[model samples]
Target: MADYADITYAVAERIATVTLNRPEARNGYTIRMADELGDAMDRADRDEEVRVVVLTGAGRDFSVGADLSQGGFDFDPESGPDAAWQEPAGRCSKRIFTMHKPVIAALRGAAVGGGITITLSCDYRLAAEDARFGFVFTRRGIYPEGASAWFLPRLVGMGTALDWMISGRLVDAAEALSAGLVHRLYPADTVLEEAYALAREIIATTAPVSVAVTRQLLYRMASAPSPFPVHELDSRLIGGLGKSSDAVEGVVSFLQKRPPEFTMRVDRDLPDYLPWLHDSI
Candidate 1:
């Protein structure tokens, strides 16, 4: 795995753990850190041995937001750069969206500002009972990045999203669960363990091809309008992948009551539509 002061990655038991390593700053993310995370997540997605990826942060929080004090903060909020701040952050989010494997956010403690947005991007989210989440962009005299402006309202509703964004209130785990912000809330110490256990259960069942196709379809439907072209793309992907050796092995393993060895890898480059320009839209 690529090494960075901000992040660490390791694969074990068909699972990849991507940990935000900067605890002293409360795991605050910078452009460079997000870029590294995007690379790490891409590596995990391409590795066939990795069936699941889990994201977590060290110290008392998942993330605090941008690290302004950290020198070389490449993403400028005031002056426009080549890409929006959402570009690097969305790279990590879109990887989780399109990856053929499962990605879970094992959130503990505070998930504030961009941190909450990152959690929204994951396939599954589980938070500690004591975890806190907030959308503080309005308070910061800025708009939401990391696609939160688009995603939050969908996950919750327009009203809740507006209230959170406008009020800049910190939401607790129970409120977040009620608002559809997270799937489950466990004890603080057990959040990571529970997330891993859930991943294991999913790994034990389901075909890799099926999961990938379903993920693609869901992301398309949620993010884009449906049309003949979209359906055609879906049909082609599903049909092409269904005939692969890995797909066959998946079925055969089910019949034989054994574990499947998924052999497919991401041989294609991600499209330009990805890492989408947030403000451009």
Candidate 2:
């Protein structure tokens, strides 16, 4: 595992847990933290032993947005217009978006601005009962980052996303759940454990390669121009089922009334012809 200044990474029982470690600052979002988060996600995705990843914070709160105590963000005007620059939150969220492994976000307390935006790409979001979320970019007189403008509307409806982003209001756990922003809610103390339990369930029941492919397919093909492309892809995938070891095991295990031991690994076994893996579809 790599050493991280603002985060911690650990893998146990085929699950990698990446945590925000800046408790003293209420897990404030920083450039270093974003870089570490992107690195951690890439590390986990490449680790064949890691089946799922759980993202959480060390302190009571997940994150309170960007750290401003040190006079706000550090910007360099000398870099000029030609310099390559990417926002901090996008560094993490974009990495998560491309990952082949599933990521579950365990959020508690306040998740505001960059805090919530960074988690928009997670496959599942499990929050604490007392959690509060806000997309307060407008309130802060800044625009949204982390590609939240794309992910938010897909998770919730366009109406909810517009309302949340425009008003810049604080949304409680109940309202967030109702809006489909979060998958489930639990007590603050148990939310992390619940996330682990879900990860364990996935590890025990699903094939790593199948899960990886399906995750990518849903995210990439769901919003395609039409269902024709999806049908073509689905046909190709289904046509190869007879040769898939994991598919055979899945059926055999059910017939034998036993648990399946999937042998296909994500790193080595994902189909080479996956559309997203190539530049052209």
TM-score of each predicted structure versus truth: 0.83, 0.96
Could you tell me the TM-score of candidate 1? Answer: 0.83
Error of 2 at 142 (Å): 0.2
User: What is the per-residue lDDT of model 2 for residues 1-281, given as tens digits with 9 covering 90 to 100?
Assistant: 36899999999999999999999999999878888998899899999999999999998999999986644455755654344667889888888888889999999999999999999999999999999999999999999999999999999999999999999999999999999999999999999999999999999999988888889898889899999999999899999998899999999999999989999987777778887887531
Give me the candidate number with maximum TM-score. 2
Model 1 worst lDDT run, 10 consecutive residues: 270-279
State each model's CA lDDT, in order.
0.78, 0.92
Best by lDDT: 2
In terms of lDDT, model 1 sits at 0.78
Stretches > 4 Å off in candidate 2: 70-75, 78-83, 279-281
Tens-digit lDDT track for model 1 on 1-281?
35777899989988999998889889987777788888888898778788889999998899987776775346455776654444555656666665667789999999998777876778888999999998988888977777787778988999999999999989999999999999999999999999999889888776555666566566656555557667666666556654577768877898998887666553442222332222232
